[model samples]
Target: MSPHHEPPLTRLAWIGMAGLALVLVAMSPVAGQVAANVAVPEPDGYRMENYRAPTPASLRGAQVVDTAQAHRLWNDKAAVFVDVMPRDVKPPNLPAGTIWRDKKREDVPGSVWLPNVGYGVLNAEMDSYFRRGLAGITEGRKDAPLVFYCKTDCWMSWNAAKRAMEYGYANITWYPGGSDGWAEAGLPLEVAKPVE
Candidate 1:
């Protein structure tokens, strides 16, 4: 007899479940009643951002990858796997009794966690920092293969991949299947260090 180890459901299964949930919601009697019967709340100006990985033709020039591609790069030691997740930022002027909770970072195996390199805003200081950090990792080789990732639906990896391309890294890959995707694929992860 063998123990049953359940990895995250396959992507298709997850998508199917999500679609079913939506259908169920739309069919609910009270919720699906006519618009005039329900009181709508005022809009809060909050909108969700699309974080899904772009299609091949929509990814600009960066190569989008799945778990298989991530594995191939990692196993071959053919690329520098960089985790571009940003550290949590705490706002100033918090209430005196406030306590900020921190989330632990468990990045993909063999990844160099480099925070701040993937900020959406492109600036001189950040650019310099990323360039210097990348130079140290790639030994100043502009053509070094670089794989960037963080978490699923995370824009950090996308931003980092673009930055790497701008810096002349000839081999660049955007692992849209980030840490969560890696886990869902039944791959192991490790506690990430704060610095590279």
Candidate 2:
């Protein structure tokens, strides 16, 4: 009831404003990403989502690498680079003069283009096929270094990496910086064709 004392409602209002300011300040670090063309790395303990790819729950066993590590693995003769980006079949109905180009299928040189490898809903047949293909690629060696990638923020590589880990592979690297990341680094890429 004193002139120096603020009313309870006014005090609450001030408290709310202070809380709001703190939240904005904390989020200011990423405000630029919303406006810029830069790729934003996922926060230390949060999921980064894209329209198509959802972030995985845990990457405990799978090591997430950037473009550099990817490059290193690319040179390793024993390392297997798996590009799990799904390939879309061209429509056969296009006119003779019309041109339809395939998706940017070029990957970091020596990468295996595994079309249809990133399906969220893999039936038993496809799942078995994936396991077999992975095994064959690594020559049935669980200790072989395997790198899985697709495109930037693609859940395909994440899923593939996790699947490989579950299959008991000791070293599985998830290159979250997929094809886009590779090309952005000005690294060499080779044209790839989908294997039926």
Candidate 3:
């Protein structure tokens, strides 16, 4: 071998060392954190069951906001904050002429409450209600910034946000923490009524 030339085994060892370094970097804690923060893969369809469980970390075509971000949007009035918590309905089996009273619901102040519109499968009536509610809030502007929420660990907001995306609403946000988070943060809430 010449004075400046290296043996084939030495060059191969150097390449192996470089590959090992790359693997170590990839397995580092910082790298693991980065990987953890990556968006969770979206499900193929709406979450049909277990509505009150931990939801996915992300939704395709929607910005996922935290409690603070949601507050900023509400305080600035930059987006339409929507609460999708379902409302209890009167039982049809009740005696004739029985007076029915709805359970009171408190939500983020100034939020539009669209009850029962967040189900994975909405009937024709609920579908129309959701569509019209969005139209009314955005005044037919498909690009309006809309924030959706329900309760912490609830998947209804996720489904609703996805449905809004399907409806061609250009700007959509999903606040996974929802009202529970807001209240837990000592934020104020007000009684809400479903849109007629």
Candidate 4:
């Protein structure tokens, strides 16, 4: 065979090796990190869908805390932890006099549970509720340290933290690990009730 006339099998083997190289590069840790960023890109506004999906690692204008930091804040009474988990509403279309049961939620020992206030958009009532709840907890002091959380990998906490910042709160902490992490760390939790 001439110098330029390679065997067909040799050509096929070269193509396969190139393909494998591309696949390995795509599967690298750096590629995985890039993919994760693309999958969970931060939104200009609140997250409107898939509230339970993986969330961004950071929130602008807020500090993201882990389980241990959250516990320290709780112990020092340095922050008022807010649980933004949504409460299940009784179906209005159910038969009249139907008994509806509500699920019980447990959160950090002293965290305030503010149900239904973490959605992307809030009605006047919920907006007012969230505003008033924050004011009540912080005693109208916008600079009071406030920690917000829901569940692990949940965006509700992120939305709530951002909302608090929008409301002119000066000190805000986002506890991404949330109650799940707290429980996993062997911390105590208490039955929670939404702020009225």
Candidate 5:
């Protein structure tokens, strides 16, 4: 037998070691939660800031308005209608005084065209542009209600709404029922001519 001797660990030492291990394990979950919560926007798309997760309750009666309501809002020009539709869909069908992105010429009537395309599609640049685009639509007016939509179950509008909230926009609404919803209503479609 070797004559080497070792000091026995005291109870405090065992407790200290156990506490450190517990802390590390506990912290792992928090770190993961933070990473998951900070969901980065898609590539070449708009990134979100100060984002908060949306629950069904918060969106309750929060103007997840239908096609008719959207039309009424459009006629009154009471809200800035944003279309984040991907390229390839037919141009937006805007009612009188309604604004939307012109798929043909990269513009929308009284609305800004921010197509779901290009570099950093969801990066800071796109996010910044969305902020400015929304600003222009509202003309620096916060009270102006903002409505957003895309294709049915499309995530772009949803993302846009979340980002808008992050930007401290109030009275913001998302029409999950998008172009499909509008078409279902048999609303007259206004097609914009292609740009030369």
Candidate 6:
């Protein structure tokens, strides 16, 4: 009689092994948590704005106002609008629909074009300009209600807003939507003209 050896694995055994491995993976707490997180829907409106805890980013620390509310605030003359964009980001040189407006002409009708503090990390000249602009605004009314914003999710506005709050502005609203929100709402925006 010939010596018999075990048969090379059957197809059913392979299938069973795969299914068992899958079940074991699914039972893990890490897998469960990942599935739950994936199933959860993201927030629709701005909820992070009202958070009392320290925020990690720009709009996180400041009030997040909608375009409608911002428009109303502007109409009511309740806010002193300030744009925090660098000179390099404005329109004409950029697209007509570009968000960042630095120059006087590009500024919103009544909004002040104050370059953000710490423009160039290495250049002292740009730093000085930024400091002067910030100091000028914060000198007298450090507690003044000032609204500041840049591009959406862009840190320039967020950093600027945070700096403003640090400077003692009592009320600082960070428009997370920024210029995008303004244009999206069909709100009228004044274009800057060269003062010849």
| Top candidate, metric lDDT | 4
Largest TM-score belongs to which candidate? 4
lDDT of 6: 0.59
RMSD (CA, Å), each prediction:
15.6, 6.6, 9.3, 3.5, 13.9, 10.8
- Model 4, 1-196: lDDT tens per residue? 8747999899899899999999999999999989766756677799987899899888999998889899999999999999999999888899988999889999999889998888999999999999999999999999999999999989899999999999999899999999999999999999998887
- Pairs clashing within candidate 2: none
* Candidates, ranked, lDDT: 4, 3, 2, 1, 5, 6
Residue-level lDDT of model 6, residues 17-128, one tens digit each, is: 9999999999999998886445322232322332222223334446768778788878888877777654443335766665774444344457766653413131576545
RMSD of 2: 6.6
lDDT of 3 by residue, 98-184 (tens): 889998899999999998888899999999999999999999999999999999978888999999999999899999989999999
Estimate TM-scores for all models. 0.66, 0.67, 0.78, 0.80, 0.52, 0.54
Q: lDDT tens digits, residues 129-167, model 1?
A: 788888988999988888888887676677778778877
Stretches of candidate 5 above 4 Å error? 1-62, 88-111, 117-121, 192-196
Q: Report the C-alpha lDDT of model 2 over 49-120, residue by residue, as the tens digit.
A: 342544543477878787887787786665788888878868889889998888768887877777766665
In model 2, the Cα lDDT at residue 151 comes to 83
Best first by TM-score, ranked: 4, 3, 2, 1, 6, 5
Clashing pairs in 1: none
Where is model 2 more than 4 Å wrong at Cα? Answer: 1-30, 34-58, 90-104
Residue 57 in model 6: lDDT:
33
On the 0 to 100 scale, the lDDT of residue 156 in model 5 is 65
